[model samples]
Target chain A: MKTTLIFLVIFCTSIANAQTLEVGLRVQKTQEMYWENGVSAQFSFAKFKPEQFFLGLDYVTSRLGTAYQSNAIKQDSYLLSGSWLFNKNKPYHIVTRFNMGYFYSDLEEDMFAAIPNTSFLVSPEVGLKYNFKKMPISLNLGVGFYIITAKEGYSPGTLQPLYYHLDLYYSILKTRKK
Target chain B: MKKISFLFIYILVTISFSCSGPTITDDLLDGEVVFDPSLYNPEQFLVSAKYPIPTPADLNKHIILAVHGYTATTFEWQEFQDWSVTPSYRISQVLLGGHGRDYNAFKNSTWEDWRSSITSEYEKLIALGYTRISLVGSSTGGTLLLELVNSGYFNNHLHPKNIFLVDPIVVPSNKLQTLVGIIGPMIVYVETDQTAAENNYWYRFRPYETINELNNVMSIVRKGLENGMTLPSGTYLKVFHSLHDPVASTTSSVLIYKGLKTSSGSKIEVQLIYSDIHVFTRLNLRTKVTLLQKNNQLDVFNQIANKLN
Candidate 1:
């Protein structure tokens, strides 16, 4: 994992020297009230340029309470994403991102035994982020829809109904290069 | 160049913002029905006997036992009442053990316990004077039914007149057994619209508590697989599988079709539906099209009813 992270860091840095890259730790409080704190590093290949875009990755894990009678549940999700900044001319840039990733969790037996529980989710998402020029931070607001398929030993012929998620993230390093 | 960039940004923003249409509010229920988890007996996992009273007073009609996939109660079939408008057949939704009422019942249960619960339901239906009985198992229930049929237990109990499986899991023991052994027991959390926190459900039963029972269940299911056991001849078996279901994969249905098809005649028919979701019942039009194109449960049941007559 360390080696991979290093390789990614070097690869992202080599994209464009004129770009401003920010590597920092982020903590996200999901709608579920569980805190997903992780290290997320982002590299903007063409900051302030017309044809500018950014690539980012985030790994988050959290344990939250279930509506069911069980005590607590744990989930590990990895996100790989790329976003295109459409309007760099304005102080507030409109950025749209597409994320492709997977999530794994170990559900309680009572829950798994009862419903056709899906352990993994494979889906894509699109979101919008608004970067403010006055502050060194950006506020990201986005929504995602995912369909989870059941795995083996799980209830088949059952659908994990389409679920929607609304997220808010505060960027730690949103700065323009000199 | 600036003008071109501005146009590109305007188009992208328009497309992104316009992608999602206004949320539909028609399906919203007028009143909220607060589900009290404590009212029902946890042991009686099936639906209340009063809600879905079996149709047809004649006990001689072919009995069809329907089991819902995980995390769901017999209430899942409440929507099917309109679709199953036939009188010659009776459908009983079997609730697996450790579901419906109490969430903790899963702590003491194994896969065998669930199978036993289903078998007992079958026995109850048979004892009620139904001569011809068909098993229609969905999701995990489908796995249980397949394992039971493969075990040769049902052969003596009345010879399953037919078996209808929807997105069954025929090969769970091989793929998930090892993971359970290592993990001991894990739980997954599901988020609800009303709840602030996600609900946690166990992924596997505790090893020390139900290890022996699980091993026994695995061994029995495995033996049936190794012996090349197939459903008895004259026993009509139909499978309705979803091509895009995330939980029960299309491969699972294919395996069941291969394992349970008898050589005597065309006793097995497999229908693969291509859809955007897993279970088809909850989906809207496009998803339902995928489900119908693959296999219609009502159609399968009617065909079996005709043959029996």
Candidate 2:
């Protein structure tokens, strides 16, 4: 996993012109399921579409949301996405993205070890993003649907297909000027 | 964007136009024409009714109450009763309230109403001096049993010796089941796609209100499991689920395993059958049956029988 993360980082940073690295929060809620909140980070390049394209990573868990100090199932998700922005000049732009990820829920007991609590995830998303030019903040909203290939009982029940998410990104490093 | 909007509107309009719910009819089991015999002649279906005044020999044998699922009647357990010819144990096929009646009754019933028959039969058995009692629930029936456990129903009553769940639906395989509240108005009721013979035993039309009721009981049970529950002292539980169940997901059993504990706090037993159908035990009216299916049914029946003995 570490090697894949390193490879992705290197590949994304070398894509066009390594410029800015934006980091902040991602809050996601699955339809009729869990509310998972976690961190999101994206890297931007100056050329080859400049701010229009991005490579990002997200890590979210129910531990920070519904399961906190409660008996709700504890689950975690990790995602890698490549996003494209439309109408790059506007403060608000349309966002289209594809994400590949993994999901796992803690059953918390060894006896339940045989139960399916993990899954592979693939999703396509579309939403809108609003950027505050003066501040280092951007608000992004997206609706995504996972294409679940595993049969019903073979996959985790909480890993539902549809989800809505809001991401708040802070510019940790500014991109190079065109 | 324009095309997507147009398509969404078109689909909504189409469904809105097609939303004429069913009315009572003789051909449909949801109508007032037919009813489960258990409602009238409980003497035949329920053991409690047959032996309201049990002899010493009757009290010594174990009595296992069999509860059926949503929209189902006592016929669901008719096979088990016929299969078990031994006098060591008896099967009480309890027909849920408002079930095997008419459409209006089913539509108007709540989850609590559906559970009344099980409790009523249990209480009757207890009152008759039957000390050794167990329970076996299938599909929604299993979920109802879970609710009973969480609600402390057995605390005051005689604790059951064992509880067996088959294809219990804590989580429905259909994801859209949770969205009944939103789409329920647009679609007043859901029609069943069952064989002619099957219609006599189960409700043909499912009202949106009853769907929500199912959702309610399922939600309650799921929450209770998450909060952790214990069986009554000396009581045990065993869950049987089809690995590829198309109605009740196997996750239901998984959650039950993770949440419920034996009276002694040990993990309950679970067996996952490699089958594609739900409630593998009920093969009486099925159009076709396979050898594997029969074996699966026999396997569970024997295990339950062994436990009861």
Q: Top model by DockQ, which number?
A: 2
Interface CA RMSD, all predictions: 15.3, 2.5
For candidate 2, write residues A1-178 as lDDT tens digits.
6735864665565544557678889899876666899988877677656788888888889999867765678888888889999998899999999998888888786655666788887999999999998998999999998887776566776677778899999887776585
Model 2: per-residue Cα lDDT over B1-309, one tens digit each: 999999899788758845666866786678777888887798998888888889999999999999999999998888999899888999999989889999889989999999999999999899989999999999999999999999999999999999999999988777666667657767788887898888888998999889999989988888888778899999989999987787787778877887898888898899888787889999998889999999999999999999987
Alpha carbon deviation, residue A40, candidate 2 (Å): 2.3
Query: What proportion of the real contacts between chains A and B does each prediction keep?
Result: 0.08, 0.30
Going through the candidates in order, their DockQ values are 0.05, 0.43
> What tens-digit string does per-residue lDDT give for candidate 1 at A51-163?
25666665655542221222223445566666676666664545666665555544433313333333444444454555556665554544443343444324332112222
Chain A vs. true chain A, TM-score per model, equals: 0.56, 0.90
Best candidate, TM-score: 2
